[model samples]
Target: MNEVKASMAGSVWKIVAKEGEQVKSGEDVAILESMKMEIPIPSEADGTVKELKVAEGDFVNEGDVIAIIE
Candidate 1:
């Protein structure tokens, strides 16, 4: 399994990939809003998204697990 982690502390702005969705490496899985900027969290592995650990508007810190892929 691979964990998709947050790149910075922020509120989740949007989820681009859903559970059970296939994703490739470098694909944006979620977007985060911080300091008026939208930062994208990309998946580092190519696989199906197994779980989402956060929802839109949820606050997350850097290195927090956003999703699990396998």
Candidate 2:
């Protein structure tokens, strides 16, 4: 399993990948809004999305686990 963590503190703007969805490496799985900028969060590994630890509008801190892939 691989954990996809937040690179910076931000509010989750959208979730582009759903649980059980297959994702490729570098694909945007989520988008975060921080400092008035849109930050795209990408998958580091190619796999199915096993879990999403956040929801839209949820605030997250750096290093927080956002999702899991397997």
Candidate 3:
């Protein structure tokens, strides 16, 4: 299993990948809102989304695990 981590602190804006969805490396899985900007969170590896650790509007810090990929 691989963990997808947040690159910066922000509120989750949207989740683009769903559980059991297959994702490629560098694919945007979620979007984060911070400082009036939208930051896209990308997957680090090619795999299926195993779990989402957060939901829309949830706050997250840098390095926080956002999703589990396998």
Tens-digit lDDT track for model 1 on 1-70? 9999998999999999999999999999999999999999999999999999999999999999999999
Worst lDDT run of 10 residues, candidate 2, spans 1-10
The true-versus-predicted C-alpha distance at residue 61 of model 1, in Å, is 0.5
Deviating ranges (above 4 Å) for candidate 2: none
How far does residue 3 in candidate 1 sit from its true spot (Å)? 0.3
TM-score for candidate 3:
0.98
Please list the C-alpha lDDT of all candidates, in the order they appear.
0.98, 0.96, 0.97
Q: lDDT by residue for model 3 over 1-70, one digit each (tens)?
A: 9999999999999999999999999999999999999999999999999999999999999999999999
**How do all the candidates rank in terms of lDDT, highest first?**
1, 3, 2
Give a tens-digit lDDT track for model 2, residues 1-70. 9999999999999999999999999999899999999999999999999999999999999999999999
What's the TM-score of every candidate structure? 0.98, 0.98, 0.98
Number of colliding residue pairs in each model? 0, 0, 0
What are the clashing pairs of model 3? none
Cα misplacement distance, residue 28 of candidate 2 (Å): 0.8
Q: Is candidate 1 or candidate 2 better by lDDT?
A: 1
Instruction: State the local distance difference test value for candidate 3.
Output: 0.97
RMSD of each: 0.4, 0.4, 0.5
